[model samples]
Target: MAPHDLIEVKNLTVSYEEAKLPVLDGLNLSLSKGETTLLLGPSGSGKSTLMYSLNGLYPEELDGKLTGERFYRERPYEAFNPGELSRRIGVVFQDPESQFCMLTVEDEVAFGLENLDTPPDVIAAKVDWALELVGLSDVKEATITALSGGMKQKLALACILAMDPELIILDEPTSLLDPHSRQAFVETVISLQQEKGFGLLIIEHNLDEWLAYVDRCLLMNRNGKLFYDGSLAQGFREHYETIQREGIWVPRLFRTAYQLMERGIIDDRKEFPMELEAISPHITHGFFTKKVSYSSGIPHLSLENVTYKHIIHPLTSTIHKGEWVAIVGANGAGKTTLSLLLAGLKAPSGGTVTLNGNRLKEYRSESLWQEVGYVFQNPEHQFVVDTVFEEVAFGLRLQDLPETEVKERTETMLEHYGLAAHKDRHPYTLSQGQKRRLSIATMMVENQGLLVLDEPTFGQDEHSAQEIITLLQQRQQEGATLVMVTHDMELVDQHADRVLVMENGTLAFDGSPEELWKKGKRWLAHHQLQQPFRVRLEQAQKKGAAAIESARA
Candidate 1:
């Protein structure tokens, strides 16, 4: 056992029940004390499984067969029980709802301490500290049901943080959160790592948010094998081409800087800027040039003075065709509710929702399905069929389409979206990313003019996300409209035609992505939204220019 290594995994292999192929194969990884490692890989790459194995959830709660060596703090894998593993390595799952054990937030945070038989007073103090650390002190007594998705996620983090584990493993912690909550949660984790110097291992696809904060980056292949492991700088430089080929989202500024280097726009051989603010000036100086323009089309969906309420607060907004608009804000900001009303899934508590100049209520649910397709955030919640083909063909079946047409459309969608190989697989057996793709593919089968996608890219890898985005863009090119309710600002910058900023249930800003970036930092910060890394690099360049001017003066 190495004294410096907190976790030593060698020749590790894991597979689920009834599956012949191992998800993770002969994998090796090591984590040292006070080091933060970012884990990156595509969906079904065993990143989540690796995290589960590290936290002792495999073979116990997961019903999987495990093999090979897994040593935690010098203890063998079989030697430690769930309680013992929980004490040393605290885990925060991707979905907060899955982790909740207690009804109230405070009680949930106290469960681990109580299990350890800590004194009541000590447990209470720790709970309070954890809540404060995650910025959830105000909601200490809130019920789990009362908290929004972001609040629930934050509460889950607090529950683990209260235990004060030596190593914290987060498996896609920000995937389900809103923009504001995701920002706050990431900041909280980074602050804790800097202040306490704990061993942090994170499996996440949103690398742009954590690149500056991470100490090291680990790349894994499809089979849960380590491809590269080293400092963040070295990983970015040495694996730049390979990483891009894998469709991973490198820092936006890095991509921009790399483009400049390729075009002979910049002669400097320096490395790309890691931080967003550091690269802003170069972008402002016009290192690269591209203009994005929106088509001149009539509004496909309009809500004129439209107002809706969920018991108390009201939400108002409008959208146009061929518009990739993102609805972003903190949790409980009515983003989901607004999406429902717009999609005609739920009738507005008040006001009118018009599609093609006709009231939504006049259209039957069946008819609305052809005009506007809505994909819920949780794919499992909307799934009705047992098999993937049936799931995607369900709507066509409902429409009484011929079996041949149904099969044709379903197979085409599956093939286009990279799910053709899994067309016969059970929906439950699919990975999180696979399920998300299936759900979106199901909606894509319908040639709707307006598509309402709620967190469409949630739980997806860079490759899956790009595939989904390209599908949406194809729809838009075919005269379909897109309204995406998401927390991912990078997705917005890369794909959106316009941005809709929501705060406290009202539309705060509706404009172009670049215009949103120009609207002052306070606006972005208030909504917990971040500018794209490329935009931040531009700002950094402007600052650098100012510094140079001062030096010349």
Candidate 2:
């Protein structure tokens, strides 16, 4: 290994005992010091499997046969003593909940230091420095239970940073974060990398935020082969077609610029904006619009001055039959609490919640679920059945449907969600994306009048996300109401007819996306949101016009 190279892998192949082929095939890669590398691949492309191997958790700790030479800091990977890698390497898991092992932020950060036998004074100082680095010093004594989703993620990072690792591996860190929180987390990581000079290996599905910071890009083919490794821009530009075909995520801005180049709206020689600072010159006023009209009738579900004890403030909303609604907000903005109340999973602590003109309390639990389907924010929360097929079939069997009909519908739903092959496998054994599909499929088997889903497309790939959206659209057309809680603004723009923007446990804005967005970019920013590129481009055009007109006057 070169002096500058932090880690290197050559001819790595990972295989399971039951499978004929390897999951990762003859991969070769390297990471340089103080640089951020983005790993791109479709779901089930062995990204997580590769990540597992990096932090010394593979072959011995986790299941898999590892064959290939790997070096960490000029030393063979196998040469490291067991558990000693924890001092040299740090990992922030995809689910922040799984990474926490302490009750307070300070303790969480100090846990690793104590494990390494650092002096108490040194541990305390390191904890303070790590929390301060992540801008969470003020919350050092805060309880883990009180921290928001974003705060928990920061705490997780603080704990890792306290260890002072040379290399940091993050697995889809932004998958569960809201727009503003995601920006904060990524910016913090970037700042620390520049400050401390540690190498970064990130596995993320969303690329829009990381475009500017990524120094190198690695693309894995659908067959688990290392397809491309090069400079970020050229790799994206060269592999655009393959990326699209393999369901790999490309930034929306990149696609937007590509479309404009195709239409001759922009010169091909002009550089596209890789960073936020360069986006203004490329802005245009084209906007995608859609109109949605509700059918004439009473709302299928209504929350009249609904309040969930201290968790949610009194907020009123209504969902008309067949109308698809989306809820977006910062993390801990009462979205999940509101979803629970609407779905009848939790009784409102104040005010009234009604469905079909009857109070939620009046409906029988069995009948209420039959008419209302709920998909949780955490897919694991809903899994009670042992296997994937049994999980989906649970709802059908509840209504006492014919066994023949139940089998037919269950199999069809499984096939539709691309889980037919894993039907016999335990639901817990599936990937995060696959688990999300099972959650949706189970609810979809029965034709419920109302469905409330929290982050429906959480871990899905581009294609799987589209498939899930298509399923929801079909249900909407068939006269079902959809209330989705999401941080994905692009999804809201394309699918939701109306958007409910919540801030601080209360309804801040509720209207059509176009109407709410008309107040412009600053307005969205105040709500901890950045508009989609098209919306921002339109806003930029308007701002440019106003500046020119004022100058003439």
CA lDDT, every prediction? Answer: 0.80, 0.83
Q: Which residue runs does candidate 2 get wrong by more than 4 Å?
A: 18-20, 135-139, 264-297, 543-553
Q: Top lDDT: which candidate number?
A: 2
Write one digit per residue (lDDT tens) for candidate 1, span 190-307.
8887787789998887665677678888887776678898887677767788887765657665677677667666653666666555445445345545534344467678776566
What would the C-alpha RMSD of candidate 2 be, to one decimal place?
Answer: 2.5
What's the number of clashes in each of the models? 13, 0
lDDT of 2 by residue, 330-406 (tens): 87788888988999999988899989999998999899998899998778899998999999999899899999999
Error of 1 at 358 (Å): 2.2
Quickly count the clashes in candidate 1.
13
lDDT of candidate 2?
0.83
Residue 75, candidate 2: Cα error in Å is 1.1
CA RMSD of each candidate after superposition? 2.6, 2.5
